[model samples]
Structures are given as structure tokens and as C-alpha cells.
Target: MWSQLTKKSVWFIGILFLSLNAYAGHHGMKKDIVDVAAGNENFSTLVAAVKAAGLVDTLKGDGPFTVFAPTNDAFAKLPEGTVEMLLKPENKDKLVAILTYHVVAGKVMAADVVKLSQAETVQGGTAMIKVMDGRVMIDNATVTGTDIKASNGVIHVIDTVLMPK
Candidate 1:
């Protein structure tokens, strides 16, 4: 009886350990940049633009990209017909340029961003970064949130849609 009880107790403890580890690991897993964007309601417009620009595959690729994602409200803040115009099939190149402008090549978190004066975006232009009064600014837009980790990259939420010059 004693041997049987010990074996049962060991089995129960082993199962409990595995179960807790599995639950913890699942919670700790990070979604990639594209998945993160698609999962969030605030990025709906950005997601639509990415699809319209034919950049879904590229963004979803194995890139440690850093995206300064703009919210739907940010897209709304553009000229009344700008988003509509950009979505047109004929404007694919322009849309691609504009969308790429928001992406940096590496996973630049807020802490590292604050140390930079400017960072070159994938669109071949540099975005001026300013830190003031504990606020971080990328061009005219403000960084509303930061360090949103993804398996393939990171996302920093911005208040304005960045435009390529």
C-alpha cells in the first residue's frame, strides 16, 4: 500500500508541474508584428493599408522590423480623401512608399529610440526623433505607446500617420 501511494503521489506532482509549465509558456509566448497589428482594433486602418499596398507578405516575413503603427484615429486625421486615394489600385507604389516609411529595419525599442536623433526607415528616408519632457516624438507625431514585443519584431504606437517626402 505504501509503495502504491508514493507512486500515485509522484505521478500527480509530475502532471501538476507539466500543466503549470505549459500554461506559463503559453501566456509568455509573443505574437509577431503582423499578427499583433491584425489582432488590435486600433490598427485596422493600418492593416487595410498594408493589404492595399500588397505589403502583407513582406511585413509578415521573418523580419525583426520595428513599426511605428498609427491608429485608426491617426488615419482619420489625414486629409479627408487621402486614405481613400491611397487605397486605389493605381496608387500602389505611392501607398507602398508611405507604408514603408513607417518601418525601421530592426527592433528598436523605446529605450534605444530615446538615444537616437534620427532613424532611417525602410523607405530610404530618415525620420527625426525628438525626446522632450519625457515624451518621444517621431516627426510631427507623438509616440503614444512603445515596446510592444512581437516574435518577429516590435511596434511603437504613434499618433500621426507618417508621410514619406
Candidate 2:
């Protein structure tokens, strides 16, 4: 009798979970990096650069690449016409350099980030690490959110975009 009751209880719980999930809206879901880049209001420039560099597939690949993605506003911080200039077909290499500058090779978490003085970027350049009074910074940008896990890699959101030297 006890085993029968336990089986019934488990069945009831499973049905209830399925029912709840079935009724809930699907729109409120965590998106992958490609979806995030395409939809998020903050990442327009980054998305454009990814497209320009022919890196959309690469970034969407099984990267585990640490992306220091910049916001639209961050791109605005560049000199006037810079974004337009970089997006041109003739400027593809430059776009690749600038975009890759924001990518680090591995999945570096915030805890690990605090310990390191610098990290090498995918562009074959190094990003300077700075911590000040509990705030963590990469290059000139402040890390707004850290350890955002993705299927391929991780994303650490930054307030400003980093440019290569």
C-alpha cells in the first residue's frame, strides 16, 4: 500500500510540473549568444562587427571564448564616423582586429578575473586588467555583469568597448 501511494504521488507531481510548464509563456527564455546579439538593444555595433568579420559562425561555434562585448553606446565613444568607417567592406581586416580585441581565448570567470593582471585577447593582443575599490575593469570598460554562461563560451558584459592598440 505504501509503495502504491508513493507511485501515485510521483505521478501527480510530474503531471503538475508538466501542466505548469505547458501554460507558461515561452517568450521569457534565456537566449543564446547569436540571438542575444541580434535582439539586445545594447549590442548593435558588436553584432555588425561580427557580421563584417565573417565571424558570426565562428563566434556561434563551440567557442568557450570569453567575449568582452561592447554596447552600442560604447561604440559611440569612438571618434565620429569610426563605426561607419569600420563597417565598410574595404575595412574588413580592421573590423576583425577591433572585434577580436574584445575576445579572450577561454572561459575566465569573475573570481579568476580578479586574480589576473592581464589576459591575452584573440586578436593576439593583451587586455589590461584593473581592479579598483571592488570594481573590476578590463581595459577601460567596467565589467557590468560576469560569468554569463553560454553553450559555446561565456560572456562578461562590459560598459565600454575595448579597442586594440
Candidate 3:
């Protein structure tokens, strides 16, 4: 009887551990696009720009948005003072336009992205999509990473910041 009780207790503990792990995994995957971006160090510039442009709430909303997120290095590649200028309150409109240019209306996965020649942006400009030398390009920015799942959408990392013409 003692051995049987011990086995039962062990089984119960094992099930509880598994259950807790599963819940954690699910919770981890539930972060929205903005939250995911903010959690990553590489997206610091992008996150700050979004906050400066007052786009944090919009990006955090229930959007199935596909974001071509540029890294801090990408922002650094811009002409000197460009990011600083855009972050100014007076340039909010331009900043919003530029940021929205990187986002699409829906959760478009990498597989679907490669099939498109161009995608219409939330900024009302169209971004030309091309696959050259086996690398995907959205406008002039090359997609370095793809299909980072968020609760509301997906993120694709880009090596350059996209500008609307």
C-alpha cells in the first residue's frame, strides 16, 4: 500500500509539472506584435519610434498586421538625424506614415509573402516585393527573418528601413 501511494503521488506531480509547462508555453506565445518587438533588444529603435509616433496602442490592438520590422542597426543606416527628426512631435505625421509603410493589414506569412509582387501598406503606399538571388525583398529592404508569430500578427525582420515614395 505504501509503494502504491508513492507511485500515485509521483504521477500526480509529473502531470502537474507538465500542465504548468504547457500553460507557460501558451502564455509566451500570446504576446502581441508590439509586445514582442518591445521585448527584443534589436527592435529598440523601432519600439521608440512607435511610441514617439503614438502608434503603440494601434500596433498593440487586435490587428492581424504583418510588420516588416527594421532592427536598430537598420535605423542607424539611415541618414544622420533622420530618425531623430522623425521622432519629433511635429513630425509625427511623417513618422506615422513611414512606420505604417512597413505594415500590412493582415497576418501574411512568409509563404504568402513570396507569392506576391507587391503589397499594399497601411500607409496607403504600395511596397514592391521581389525575390532576387533567393532572398526576399520588400521595397529596398531585404527580409532577414520571417514569420515570427505574435498573438495578433506576424513579424518579419528587415535589414533596412523602408521609405514611402
Candidate with maximal TM-score: 3
Q: How close to the true structure is residue 138 of candidate 3, measured as C-alpha lDDT?
A: 96
Residues 11-123 of candidate 2: C-alpha lDDT, one tens digit per residue: 99999988777765353334556666777778878898899889998887766788888888888988899999989999999899988998888778888999999999999
After TM-score superposition, the amount by which residue 123's alpha carbon in candidate 1 deviates from its true location, in angstroms, is 0.5
Ranked candidates (lDDT, high to low): 3, 1, 2
Alpha-carbon local distance difference test for all models: 0.93, 0.84, 0.96
- For residues 53-145, write the lDDT of model 3, one tens digit per residue: 999999989888999999999999999999999999999999999999999999999999999999999999999999999999998999999
**Which has the higher TM-score value, candidate number 1 or candidate number 3?**
3
Candidate 1: regions farther than 4 A off:
1-29
Which should have the higher TM-score, number 2 or number 3? Answer: 3
RMSD vs true structure, all candidates: 4.5, 7.0, 3.6
TM-score of 2: 0.78
TM-score versus the correct structure, for each prediction: 0.84, 0.78, 0.85
Ranking by TM-score: 3, 1, 2
**Candidate 2 segments whose C-alpha is farther than 4 A from its true place:** 1-31
For candidate 1, lDDT tens digit of each residue in 6-30? 9999999999999998986787556
